[model samples]
Target: MELPLDSPADQLLLAGDQVLLVGSSYGGRPLAASRGTAPGGDAVGRIAPGPEVPKLVLRTVDISDPAAPHITATLEVEGAAVDTRVVGGIARVVVRSQPASLDFVYPSGPSSEQRAAEINRQIVEDSTIDHWLPSYALEAGGQQSAGRTVACDQVHRPASFSGFSLLSVLTVDLAAGLSAGAGAGVLADGQRVYASPENLYVALDRYEDVPVPETAAPETIPATTVPTPTAAPPASTAIHKFSITGAEPAAYLASGTVDGLLLNDFSMSEHEGVLRVATTVGAGRWGNAVADDGAPVSESFVTTFAQDGEQLAQLGQVGGLGLGEQIFGVRFLGAVGYVVTFRQTDPLYTIDLADPANPAVRGELEILGYSAYLHPLGDGRLLGVGQDATAEGVRTGAQVSLFDVADPADPQRLSQLTLPDGWTSAEHDRHAFLWWAAAGLAVLPVEGATVSADGSAVAPFSGVVGIGVEGDQLAERGRFGHPAQDPTCPPGPEPRLVPSDDGGPEAAAVPAPPATALPTTVAPSPALGGDEAGAGTSSVGGGSSSGVAPAVVDSPWCQPFEPPISRSLVIGEVLYTLSDAGLQANDLQSLATLGWAPFA
Candidate 1:
């Protein structure tokens, strides 16, 4: 699954307090076409994967001992890990695959477009069901399976047409030591997934009145096969609901349509017997022809639906919020909803959903910066994570805001902590954020570096930033760095938290280590970005030139091979983070590095 802007995460599932599953899951742009062998070659005439493409690698870990967690099993599946969900102790992994006919040299290229289309159709019709579905290999109990396929029934064509791509939902029982559980398949494409305790929803963008170019969409709907929307203006989205209630495979329950496209999992929420989704309507697909007056064309909306017979019928909707901007953050908490949109500034709008059929915008508050993620802090308060921008809307760096929504119609900004010139994955990836209520700490993966005017990094650092929240105030509890991937290129400097020039409160630094101090990391290295101030530095691909650089680079920044910590968990008094390098545990309260272990 390939997508831009949004990076689908490799999920880490923590089962109770003993285990964690980390790898591909959630949001993708279907499958991409890769080059194969020559005509009538291995892949051209058969169902073979691209030579350069590898199957999704999943690791099942035992975290019972946080300080020394170990991998219990590894499963490799042939496809992109689309998503995963755990309920009633069983985990469901969704994967999408498109066995391509790469390197299909049609005897010095096909004669014409029609001829190329004909050849492709033949390849599809001749392929069997197993070839289109996901196949997996599991290694556990000191044994490895040669391979296994996601079993399902005959591939039936959808009446509306959804191409011949394969998407599978595989069940896995972690307690059973990484066994590939009962699996099922559907011939559809959707990047977003929303799940309730009893239901799983897949939302596919719909191109109703939009005119898609012939090259972007399939030449024809296909007599019975072809892909869905490849590139088109989505006027709405079709929701396909599947039941994950019992032992049987995820059974399709119903279907419905909602105006505009969904933002993320937060875009849809299932309450009582209704489903509410927030989206940006009128997403311009007609490239040049936007609003005639050069105004913001797309608008934000909250629409509600309820299952009536076999369809999710639309009931009510509220629109006209954030005239021209898209949603930055969306959170539906029971009968209330919060949507954040940004352009020149941030507008945090509150929605009243007490009456599902009459959802309306209750109140709104405008601020200088916008929040990308929102977390409930109990007692009518919300924690927002995003960038602190200038009055002109230029993002300075990372910003943390505590909002008092006690009065929904009149929300207030309780406190603000703005960091000038650093970046954090937690801004876009929710999986990278952890809120431990018991300890009153919010931790997210952050990377800070002193970038010179010429664009070279002075001392780049990466790790987690702990934010202490109580009532309406926010404090920087501590900043921790990761073990260097290369001793030669050490994480530039340990980052220290500082206050902004705007007279904001200074961060209470992590106390100096005493003789009794738990094993910890290096000292603080200030993250300096021009005149703005930020907290700690971080890395997706630890210290890589690009946050998640795909290759090696000989630069000023640390080119450490160690992958930076990306996901975290709070077990008892210890905070554990995971990365390709290994696992590290920290003393929860003081953010003292307690222990670090390398993987096998």
Candidate 2:
């Protein structure tokens, strides 16, 4: 009879003149009681497992007081009990089991035999348990349990130290029986014993000499200054072909993570075949300080190509109040570049980028709230679109702010428009759950408007809730929004008193290339007047003081800031956008100024 070890566990029993330790991983112990009867004492036991792995524990009890024979607990080590001795008139039974080691990152499952063996080996080679530390006590379940130290066979263990240390002593009381889950440890004077969840001990100091691997960080390139170009004749115009699809390539250019800075908005522009992007950066860092005076301050950098995708240049990266931080939006007012930031008190900043590389502060208009997108109306003017607080204190959607930049140095707000009643401002407010720097409304140019050759006027630019003339006072034209085509909604309100031709702007749609083929090999353009041909202009005449471009200038289509030395050419008076994935050319020969072809 194998004693049915695999069956559900049962409490151990000590018959008269017999000490039977059941579930002892061995045959129950049979020690004759002093008076030829079982001890009338109680015992306790407890076992806790690992978080990701399962383990086991066992404890015994003696409460019958069968003649009150001194109870002795023994744990076999390799089937051999060593150093069974008595200290201070009490039997100190200490068994040295192997160290308990566990795999920190284990799969979701039970522990393997190999893992348990390893843990046992570590414990045996590295741990030391004191015999006097072993004790037995009774538990609530009225079962026998054994623990680390003896507590004069009386008193309860303090709850504060419970479950904290592997060493515990149960002060056995004259209870009826031992209790289950009663664990204890004996703290013998030693410093190297590493406590483990399975009640096994190991020496951490021994493993301190083990070498661990180090982690490596990803590489990053820093920003540098742009090089000066030499004077040369304007390059020849070439017909650069582009796929009609307006999809942008997914390849990442220069990228870095800026913690604590929520990106308010971002836009991309092209100069000299290099992609220059402006992003409004800010966040909780700004608290109301008297010195702040209700002004927005921060730092921003312009990322652009230096050479053939190998190097990058950073410009307009200044740090100060109302300079770098105040910039709200960055857009190309025509060919001229401009940055829109805000002040603490006022809510608008119109920066003139007559110089693309170096931007100069033009006008700072104090709007009620903040601007979401800035659309260039060409020639020192821009259409700022966002929401404003209504009299009811609600934010209406798409409040249009028209401005006149007749003087790039002093941009004034022409007018402000608000959303109609019934619409809520909460829709525009930020949600705490969503990341502040995620996606928002993208301000795309209205196709064909004033920049198209046919100049179709059937676009969304027909309404003007507000308009700010160069020298005129800002006036509220009327409220307006996209008219619904659904017949259910009685023709939407037409708020513009003097609506411009809606069919003015037109975009040339390109035909998609035939499928089942790889990208076609494009022919390089003819030699230019050398690198000097790379000269770029912020305006038609020259670059501005900022070394970039004027934000108010207009370009019929996307044009490169300057010419680049590449077999890839974009020419004619068409606008061309280039990146690592290649180029996209928009034909804008009809726009007032700022139009160019690819491969020129």
Candidate 3:
């Protein structure tokens, strides 16, 4: 059931009968509170004056009854919630807050030019390092005021300062119903967080524009003869580690800067007290020229760090991976790490992190397209969901690849299935993909379009496709759309594949056979003990124990306003899918809908 609140819900966690919802609430600032300087000076320029304050509200909801859920308690604090994680009986949330005086305050009676000068002066005054650094006082007219200030001693600071972004972690005890103090540290803005059972890692990408100083040439010299200044290098990422098990979250254990940017949250992994980070470095912003002075260039690196008490000690680093390419995906399985980087070709690099002090690349396999999301299949196999592309790196459509990495030195793609005119949600959000190991089944939300014989594109169809994995091969169980389409019927003809142009040595390693068209129809395969007659098709309200099929509906090719399929999870013999529409449960074996609950 839906528990409506005044603010927009940012995150939610369900533990037993207790539900925690974090929402962002915006309200006008008090008149008296608008005159002071914010914790960090107004480096965030050109905005409204005295903007509304954003407060994060944590609402505890009791969900004992499935039909009704009510709010139990709430704790409000200043900031916008970024992410939340629940473990045991405690919940940790990451919030970002700004100073109340972050906006500009102009003098009441000044000319336009004078007002501009005053604003610039205020900006310069606010841009001081004192404002950017934590622990600064929030004051106006030399008077102490009640305002938000981040404790500097609690956070790790960079050697140089830039603009300001304050990050706070809030800890809540669900059992005790207590709110801990704002987290133990401050961080630069726009950070992605990754957590382990014992520690948390925060990564921040920092970029500073290098000002080009003008040259004063002799009057005889031509203006065109002046050489332009070289562009600055690519941005860097600073990673900080914090301990989670303390009265208050411990301060940053250790911090280090990597010479690159992380692709996303999947780029980091912590295993057995060691942290491995994969990043794409040296790709200068805006296609800037790279210096040829033996400096680093566009490449990916897998760096390893070992935890020592309160510090993360850099063990070893392996660089120069996928030269001239950007990292698309990274996954770590114990001591082995897989990295996918793409430009003209996809290079799947296998990195061995068993020896953290001397990490090395174990293998490199070049393919036509890259994988944006990678999932382990429990054996030596990996399931990759991403776009298929030609040898020139032109992405075509959604593709699923089964890779066998049993031999790290020679990983092989055992099977590949592609839909020429479709995209799957799993590519960008791994949570949309579900794996049922017992049934050897994998399901993902897919949407595709087709061009009829008249050369006109037919409306696209959205559904969930079930893939059955047996040994080294992949089989399409069937596609189940909403509104319960014909299950015994067949799908339309498969889309055509684009031929590759590359015929290099790497491309010759495992030559792909001619593409095969998928069968139009699939036979009904009931659950282990389900009846075959009850498996034809069923909708949300009507379905048999065997399975309930999804409904089929036509949609536009570019559906910008389409509600997304947010989450998919499998429990026991049932599969649950959550979307804006509501929650749906399907039989894991028959791929049929069992029940659905709409938002109340």
Candidate 4:
């Protein structure tokens, strides 16, 4: 099934008769009338099209008629939809945003800093809790909702100040629709999300503000040097857990704090009523902490948590797993766990999680490259998909390795395949990788762009690559991609979408070319922690903020991805590949093309 989604989707969910699409950040006029709290604490009766005000779009399409799928409902919310999970008959979406409608004076340098700061503080103090919660408008069937604000009673706040970003987890009943759902807020910022059938977890890094002495003038403060207490602060992660076991609204169960930051949702798992977490500490978010001699000093650890009333308390922790290295992958399988850390060589450590109170490393395997994502391949084998690097840590391309983990004490790489210059969407999104155990097939979206020695031209290709999971090896069976657009243009930088004159969205720019893409031999992956972009001035009146931007910045990949395949699925004997460009179906056995449907 295929339907046009103006904005890029961060994730997709398939329900019985509907396909749900959600984009973290969108910049267009509301697809339908919007009634929500505007970014600046004002009531937005109807939101207009503009890039200035960030928006999250959630559209549900009725796919009952495969040949002509259409959007039946849309909820345009004032915030970024971080991630979502569907349980039984309800979908819970986590959105991170803040009230930006308040107009505070922008400081005129150090002289006006204190005054602006004070003005912002007053505005925040005077504002109600509704100003900090996400607002939304729902349009379904021919009915519209005048949504209510997230009640103060439903929101959870941290003991210390945790920035201005408010995280809201909204629930929508799949069968009952959005009218019967509600949302709750957590007074903290979050990015990575992990969910099981029973619970969902959101993990985000906490920033420490260096306080200036009340006696010191703004101009007298040192710009680069720390005043005092400059010991390297341990990077911390705040996790919020919610129960999704019932069809009722998602209930905020507990919240906890860890001493490190997570790589992604994979860094968290729930088993036997306990939550296991993995993170990298002693680094500044991105694991770039360095010693006086310019060596990496970051370390990783695994922690366990159990519910204690309304709080999640730490139970046990195993640290020093990868000294001077950061975590690349994590997966907790039942009573066992796997952690991958990489610097020059990849160290795969298997942990014993049977005893939640005493987790320990049982065995380790060192390999040349690292796996950013891992999947269990039946019985006792693990499949890894990530960049293949040389002994010097220079990444060559994407590699797929099968490991024998049946023997936890002695893990070994059974077979491997490396594509010299390839990149896959699966490295960052596990949803993009499909494991069909019944057919012994593993499918993923992969691309490789080969530039001429002079770098003037390139051959760029992207498609669904099917790898046969034979007895002990992984070999490529076949690959296929969508038909190229007429008179193809070379790929360069991915075009960013901006608000159009009519309130619709359009690409800011497109790569001009002689029909070739410009992707580099090595794919770019922002390890663990990410860069926080500085916010430029907003419309004059908006008050002061810390380090948060209106929306999160994109990754560091420079080359433009012209509709890279993002997901693949198997239905009986047909394999379906999906991307922004369209959806394609091929024979599950012979890689023969069956059909292609472009989104309208």
Q: List model 1 lDDT by residue over 121-189, tens digit each.
A: 676678765556666778877988844455555232333444355556666665655666555556766
Residue 581, model 3, lDDT: 52
Q: For residues 1-600, what per-residue lDDT tens digits would candidate 3 score against the true structure?
A: 456688877777777887777787777654443343322221122444244667777777778897898776666666667676565567777766654454554432112335545665777577754444223222223343333334556655544442356666667776544343445655455468887777777777877544323243233345355334354455888776767774455455766667788888888888888888997776655433234563435778988888665455678999879876788888989999999988767889899998988899999888888898999997799998888899877988778899999999999999987766778878877768888888998888877624221334544535566788988998776554433222233343445444446744332233343333322223343333344432432322111211222233232221122234567788777776766755666777766656555453
Summing lDDT over every window of 10 consecutive residues in candidate 2, give the lowest-scoring window.
236-245
TM-score against truth, every candidate: 0.69, 0.28, 0.73, 0.75
What does candidate 3 score in Cα RMSD to the true structure? 13.9
Among these predictions, the greatest lDDT belongs to: 4
Error of 2 at 80 (Å): 65
Candidate 4 lDDT over 1-600, as tens digits, reads 446567777666777877777875555433444443323232324322344567778788777888999888888788887878777767888888766554444442334455556666787688875666667788889988855436567787765555577788888766554453667777878888888889988888875644556566545555565655333455788888888778767777778888878888889999999999998886664346457676657888999999998688999999878777788988889989999998878999999989999999999999998998999977999999998889988998888899999989999999997666788878897888999988999988768734221233334545666788899977777655654432233354555566666776554554332334332322121211222111111111112111112222233333343456788888888787777766766667876556555565
- Give the range where candidate 4 is weakest over 10 consecutive residues by summed lDDT: 537-546
What's the lDDT for residue 255 in model 2? 18
Which candidate should be chosen as best, given TM-score against the real structure?
4
Task: Flag the better candidate by TM-score, 1 or 3.
Answer: 3
Q: Which stretches of candidate 4 lie over 4 Å from their true place?
A: 1-11, 23-51, 66-72, 103-121, 209-233, 289-296, 449-461, 487-563, 595-600
Worst lDDT run of 10 residues, candidate 3, spans: 539-548
Candidate 2 lDDT over residue span 1-600, tens digit each: 022233222233333343323222332223322211112211111122232221122233343464454333322121112112222222222222211231122111122324444444564455443412333333334334445332323222321221212322211111222232222222221111211111111111001111111231111212232222221111111000111111111111221111122233234444444334443333223321123354433444333322223123344432332442344455654435455444332335444444555655555555564465565554555666555554433453445567776776566777664443222221232110111111111112111122111222222221112122333333332111111111122332333333335644543444332222211212222222222222321111111201122222122232222221111122443333332222333222211122222322
State how far residue 216 of model 1 sits from its true place (Å): 17
The true-versus-predicted C-alpha distance at residue 226 of model 2, in Å, is: 42
Candidate-wise lDDT, in order: 0.66, 0.30, 0.65, 0.71
Give candidate 2 misplaced runs (Cα > 4 Å).
Answer: 1-266, 280-309, 321-328, 342-344, 352-357, 389-398, 419-600
| lDDT score, candidate 1, position 192 | 79
